[model samples]
Target: FGTDTANQVEEALKSFKQANVQTLVLDLRDNGGGYLTAATDILDLFFSSDEVIYQMKEKNSAAKKYYASTDSKYEFVNGYILVNGNTASASELTAGALQSEKGYQLVGTTTYGKGSAQTQKTLSDGSVLKYTYAKWMIPNGTCINGKGLTPDIEVENVSLDGISTKDVKETLKVDCVNTRIKSMQKMLNILGYSADREDGYFSVATQDALKKFEADNDLTVDGEYSQNDKQMMIARMMIYINNHENDKQYEYLMKIIK
Candidate 1:
């Protein structure tokens, strides 16, 4: 959320209204969250002035309830929020509020589970300190600090889900045993190649899968995973996800909407 995000959402809602779009799917995947006021502003679009958006509990102070102050511009008969493990803070707040108050269903995976509010202060020594001072909760008064909001409909995107590739340092070949090999094996298996195992060991089957991928992509027929091969695999995986050829979560959402 930013200063302009609410404005953009308002404009989008206006367009949707003009187009007679009655249902809404708010995609909040990988949103790490931002300003609280921005979130409240966006929530104001879907809630009335008397509705409580969220509650804040600061140290040694009574919990304060924040209410929406504006009328909703558009009312959807059905609404869903698409979230993932990376959705945090204000994103969780918005999702939780809508889910609790408006009966909106949350689709996709669990959220990132960050419910604290933080502030920063500059000291006299020219240093800055940032720290969490308060906790926020949904309208039900349940704080989702460590436990993320569970999805009403759980859906996993298996084709694009895998271990991180940041620690892949060296070239991987048959007989290599490391996390990189495991990550590569998982990717290859998800991409429809038979890597046989994903236990961090690069077997002959893994080598063969690599070779097949290389041959299919017009690369050298080497049964090894180099940095270039990793890059190519990531690019291809991105294209696959971007094309949405097999988005199970989205498919389920469409089915439910129909």
Candidate 2:
């Protein structure tokens, strides 16, 4: 990661330490991934020193393993991780590492299962060379490329008439009453949006929260939550939970609701 992302994570961890959070749930659903170094650095925040976090092997090259160098400063007694089919690459790496190494509970569906490592190089002809040069494995020694790691507890997503909640554009707006609304509100609350209640009622507060999420994500500002907006909201919530699971308000909502 760059300075900006690292600085933001440090700020969040500082706030979490100040809050004295004990339990945390890191959500990795729909996270495609970024820099591998960034993922490993974040994993370092949870693991003890001398634990192997990742192993990499390139073509005809010896495998190299990376270990945690320091004990986790902000340790938690109970830690959970959430994942889904859209979680891939470095996201999958982090999830697998925590599950296999630290015994973190994984909840939700199977991950996207991308395990190869790629690198980009500028050639002498000014063209770029980008290709898969290696593959990575978690502490368990299993490479999650095509075969994804299953969750310890699989929680099905709420749906209506065989349609997922994120696809139901009409019934997901303000004042809607459905079982899936609770999931929507829970996600909103997890993302630091003011979804007042999780009683399956898309109330005014929920609508306002949806509006704020849309506005912040560069979507059309409206109370009506479209399918795209709902998906984006879920993605953003996953990112937020992955980064700020120890935030006081997020932990409070997680204990009170889902």
Candidate 3:
């Protein structure tokens, strides 16, 4: 804001550089509700202008690009975001900027999926009413409104005995997961879902495997895959490909199952 939010951020970053603070944690919880333009501007520091920081969608169609400024150069490294369940509005935007744009380590949980961007429209009654106008999507062309961005890793808020039993730590390497999803031929080869060899990337063999999984689970096996189905597919594959390396393959697998 004109009141000095941007400068404060700059100053903070400068201070971090001067202080040489390692393992920085940006706590953006319980503080949100902001102007859309401002959020996008701040996003510039962590992403290039060519990057589509986020998008605006009116209907359920593909999002329209709300691109970053091309003249801007933002690259943040070694970032850790501490987001909680109660965070909303502009706060969510900040967290999303870090997560979607920078791919920072998210250590709390999933975020609120309020996709529609809102504005305070002044009515004839001389009163301002909040009206939702457009939904928001990340630069990668993924919607983040009704469906919040899932964490690359899942961790809990509470822990004891220097260990956590109350929560599940499911670490998701973006590339590895996607590799596993896309390359279904390999999974099929090993699982005996088909006689197809693992060529990496989803082909007819992968789709067929997905259908079989859905049929077995009594879930609707639509050739068109998705997030829930993707998770299910990966879980089944995990049983077979336990802690398998080859990140590209993993990413392919994640995408197909998703």
Give one digit per residue, the lDDT tens place, for model 2 in 125-156: 99998999999998767889888778887765
* Model 3, span 1-27: residue lDDT tens: 334565577677777767775445566
Candidate 2 has an lDDT of 0.75
What are the lDDT scores of the predictions, listed in order? Answer: 0.88, 0.75, 0.57
Ranking the candidates on lDDT from highest down gives 1, 2, 3
Most accurate candidate by lDDT: 1
Q: Which residues of candidate 1, in runs, are more than 4 Å off?
A: 159-170
* TM-score quality measure for candidate 1: 0.94
| Deviation of model 3 at 192, angstroms | 53
Candidate with maximal TM-score: 1
Prediction 3 TM-score vs. true: 0.53
* Residue pairs with clashing backbones, model 1: none
Q: What is the lDDT of residue 57 in candidate 3?
A: 78
Steric clash count of candidate 3: 37
